[model samples]
Target: MTSLWQHARRPATRDDDSWSVAGNVYYGTGRPIDGMERPFSPEFEAKVRHAYKSNGPVFALMTVRQMLFSEARFQFRQMRNGRPGELFGTADLALLETPWPGGTTGNLLSRMIQFADLEGSAYVTNYNPGRLKMLRPDWVTIITGSEEEPSLASEAIDSELLGYMYDPPTGSEPWFLLPEQVAHFAPIPDPEFQFRGMSWITPVIREIVGDTAATRHKLKFFENGATPQVVVSLDPSVTPEKVKKFQALMDSDHRGVDTAYKTLYLGGGADVTVVGKDLHQLDFKATQGAGETRLAAAAGVPSVVVGFSEGLAGSSLNAGNYSSSRRRLADGTMRPLWREAAGSLAQIVNVPAGADLWYDDRDIAWLREDQHDAAEIQGLQSRTIRTLVDAGYEPETVVAAVAAEDYSLLKHSGLYSVQLQKPGTGSGAPSPTPPTTDPEVP
Candidate 1:
């Protein structure tokens, strides 16, 4: 098949020694006839990483995602008459299993999810046939081109995806890869851009900031004698120098968790009035929990699944509710991500003629309940197949009908079973002794 890049003009190349310098030169230089480069913001990605590392809820949510996503292994699945058939393993899967030397499928998957969550996209390239390399999403640029002359105004409609450019931080010459050579996984689409993704965290950035601020407040509360602020009044006769010395002494002696609840000595004419509310009055739990829930919601993970305060409190921890939450994360979030990842990675892998790349979650412990549910569903389908076959439907068609849940696919044979047939018409019944006796008697 002729590739899109083959028809488009080649992008102008610069002999600049530094990739950053070339990038600066090309920045905002209107769309080239060859291709337009779309780069992710490194600053935003850095902030995402900082949140992942510093925020407890964000960390937990992403960790849960990575842990579950990595459990699914890649396989080949063929479509049977527009429906998915059984998944079969292939040698091509080996590339994913051991993407790089000493790197397991889990490592590769973790990196992919981490990058995707952080930067809103993940890029993988098999520039070297047998080995797979993950490109830093922020460092990689998507190259789009069009057959028509490039115009800034209509670039969105006219351009077609050409390939990718990987610019390393070492100021080395960037490597340009064909679309087929790179696998781009962007689960969430960016609203403002074409052919780009937006991070789940983007929507909940305010929540994250709020949560971090709340955490800082809690730490400060503890650091400040673990008590609320108090207003101190002194008599007019007291010297300013004396007040300053007394204030310094109070702070030095009473500040921090270790000195909390210590006895306070007040001299004559000194009065301390309690002013600020304590942690209980402030309701820190509710404050932070609300933000955590919002973050979890954005991540498409139930707060319960990540053990957030909101999820663990009240009825959320009930067995049924917890189970539902787990299912939501597994089915709603992880499965879709895995599906997208498989499809993206397929671009670089040699897929079988009749098969597409897919993920197999049968072995994942987190989805054991799903496996049980599947078994029950299979059993029901088996009963349906048996009933249809016994009703004289073609066995193949019966199986297909049961599998697809479309009874219209069933085809009946020209014969019926004994129960379905009228009294003596059934083949199972003894035929009337027609011949000799009847003739003789007649």
Candidate 2:
């Protein structure tokens, strides 16, 4: 594998003289002047990774990403009459199931979603050996393009995508990929650009930074012993030099975790005065909890779901609100993401005309409540069909109309059952009135 720096020194197409800068200044090879990777560097990846490792909210965000990609299952359907016609399998099935030679569908999708959520967009190139299969996501720096044509006059279009420049991480010679050979997935797309998505992490970065700072503060506080105090004395006989020496001795003997609570030996009328406040006094618990809660909220996860102690013992634990929060997390946060990713995949996979890619959330245990609701609704629909059929309507028509929501199936044969009396006709008792008239006459 050739290094990115080496790849940049290779020949470039068009006016891509942007690599004239120092090799270290270039993020990766094959990038254009206006490419999104222009600002990216190895250092940026490290920074994001550090935040991921140190921040609580980033962990929650990643949890959401994993659940969305793994739990939501994608399927293909055929289109008919401007609607989804039927379920059918295509070459896309095999391709998606084994996106890479070694990867499963779930792994591929999960990786793509994670990268997109973190980096704003994910790019994958389709490699066909014998068939149109095999996919590999490229790092942002490894792929570059210029927006020669905007989809809208104001925004770039996919058709305008000239080509993809791929610089392998192994330091291989750089190569150019035609636009047709690659698939770009962007969830929150940039309105002004065609190739990039807006990162969800960008908005909550400050919250993440704050959480990291708080964690580090707590660690340092505990490492220096679980107490905060300042010792002062009113010993006029003691010189300032003696006080400085005493402070040094105190730090060495009692300030560390191992030396915490060790007895301090003082002499020459030196008095120890506790001046610093404890962690509780500084509202450490509140600040940390509040930061986690804010981060969870930004990630669309209720704090309780992410195991945050804040509000877990209070109203957030109530069954109703907790269930509602779970539902909101699934519907409001995750489902839309699933839909977006499925849509992007449809572009890569050969979806049958009229059929679109859809997700199967029915099997996900986290959303079993929705399945229960669906069962109850199904029961109601069955009752509707029975009632309609008993009302002299054709059973087939009733079922079809109810199932398809097509009122045209409600065209009923104007006929009554033997049990139901015919319209505009009297009851078949002939004349019970005749006997009463005879009695009146007598």
Candidate 3:
């Protein structure tokens, strides 16, 4: 097997401004110039990072990264007849466990999930032995091309994934890496682009903006003396200077939380009119909680899992509902992510023949509730194998058939068990007791 560093050493040659060799294909020759460098939008990535740090709901959703990083380990799994078989470890597994000098698999996974979630894609490259580097998603560009000169009309179908280009913002020359040397993980693909991925946050950007605005509004309410807007009306006879003086006094004495509930001494002919509603009157929790739920939905995590207000209220915290929510997140979201991560990282790992890199989630505490279901399924499969073996089927074929859930794979052994055979029909059986009865009659 070729090492990742060995593949990285063979950088694609750039022929000219218009054409370049990326992996096995000439990237710029037939591809559109505008589509040549496909980089994740930096502005969007920045916005996601900001929201993750500043917003409550987004931050809560990001906590899923910890669970993902902690729950699973990578190993080689044998594939037999389209079914996963035994899982085994090898020297290559060490690379994932200790990707760098001090990095563990969790560290690598956390970074992968963070970048993938925030930027819609993550790239992992191995330029040195026993060390892996994660590229900034927005800085790395995907390079695609065609094996043959594609026509303008057939480019979409003829185009193939070539590799990636890592162009840093420090004005250094870009590094070109073959596809096998870099693991490109984009769990969510962008519908607009052929190879680009789309961020889950993209769909709920409006919701995030609304939620942020609501938070700011709450802060401002407290800043303004924790009171609703008040319009001070002075009589027509009052002088402008007096009105200005009164406004200044109010701002100085009672305009902030520090001065909240202070006595207000209004001059004669002054009328105070309250405008707008307080936080309670606005039902702040319901408003912000709805947006939080929407954001969680987009994150593929149930609101209950994130401890959002909407999820915590009512019966969402009930044992059954909570378990279901956990199951949804584990099975529907994290499992798929782990699978994709394994497949992508397979590019850098040395996998044995008939074996694929897979995540071992059996030890994940988050999914321990699923153990009962797994055991039940195993019991059923064991019983099926036993029945099939006793019914004249080959033992090996019976096991394979039961495992694959395809009884057609079972082969007959042309023999039957004692229970399934006719009485006294075997070669070892006594000749029918008729001889003894005939001797007695004679």
Candidate 4:
């Protein structure tokens, strides 16, 4: 970008009053271009490539300082020379094109993106009075402030082209205190109001950024069970063949399904973890339903419980459980499992309602077979495991009984078709050979 100042480099012959900028602007101006306003060209890209290949690190340092100066309005301030916007320093610049090395275009577009973001926020921090009026007069924009923003319009947003929003001021300068302005901190405040203005208008600067990024190289996305892909241009209209190279760029990189699932459900916090246990050292006990309990257990150094939290943070996930896979929201239909379990003896089982005891088919049968006594059932229900005495059934048996289901047996056991005299062994029928494989075979 051309500065608001010009100095003669050589000795002036009376009327000649011009001077070249000295000392490398980092290594003397790396490449004198047509200027900053016009967009990139092949010639410009080539110049940038030469500058970087010859002196990238130096050019990068120079561009960084220039970007900061142009964004800071240091040169513009200096050129005013005690006129309207005068100041002094090596940081004198009003405007500047991004001067970093773009990978393909040889311009540093990624760096430009960072500079734009920083410049916008930095501009806001200074509380400049002239910035509101500095926008191109041709572009229509709206600014809002009750009394202070005299250069602004009345509405929070406007219809013509650009608009902005700010809080109703307690005082003129309090516009700086507005939370929306603070959180978003827009550059030149966005065009905003009439309710048509939304957060999306913030992308007006993206044309510069997008084109810059596209010219350099391609952006890529590697998704699990999907393509690792790249695109020449983010423009949706760009031909797909142009972006086909992304397929080759995407290597396995050791990313896995757990990473994908975490990206989906947890929305990408820290990456997923793995816990390996040596099976040879672990004892094998015939603990009934122990495998299923993993969903409820939340212990160990790395704890991961499924189907436990009722409403995880901000969303819903209680969608399934057990063989029956009871309706996700059974509470609507008196099927609060805790209540049903608690009231079975009295009428309103507490188990389904309060989540004390989950039902296992074998547990109910064992209770009925060995101890149909009311005291035993009620005692087990009311007392914690520690408070209750030995109930005759082993832990494994009780667990298996309570955790068991009859769904698999009901499916293929002909119970659905044959007229049943009684269910299970009570029918007094001879046992048939079980299927060699799964009863629910595909």
TM-score of each: 0.85, 0.76, 0.86, 0.15
In the order shown, the candidates' Cα RMSDs to the true structure are: 6.4, 7.1, 7.7, 34.0
Residue lDDT tens for model 2, 124-190: 6665642333223333332333244211212334333445555546766556666566666677864
Query: 1 or 3, which is superior by lDDT?
Result: 1
lDDT of 1: 0.78
Model 3 lDDT vs. the true structure? 0.76
How many Å off is the CA of 210 in candidate 1? 0.8
Better of 1 and 4 by TM-score: 1
Off by over 4 Å in 4: 1-201, 204-442
Model 3 pairs in collision: none
Segments in model 2 whose C-alpha atoms lie over 4 Å from true places: 1-39, 42-44, 85-91, 129-138, 141-159, 168-171, 191-194, 231-245, 387-442
Residues 109-153 of candidate 1 have per-residue lDDT tens digits of: 999999888778899999997999999886776666656644442
Give the candidate order by descending lDDT. Answer: 1, 3, 2, 4
Q: Go through the candidates in order and give the clash count of each.
A: 1, 12, 0, 50
Best-to-worst order by TM-score is 3, 1, 2, 4
lDDT of 3 by residue, 317-350 (tens): 9999999999899989999999999999999998
Q: What lDDT would candidate 4 get against the real structure?
A: 0.24
| Candidate with best TM-score | 3
In candidate 1, which residue pairs clash? Answer: 225-256
In order, candidate lDDTs are 0.78, 0.63, 0.76, 0.24
Task: Please give the TM-score that candidate 1 achieves against the real structure.
Answer: 0.85
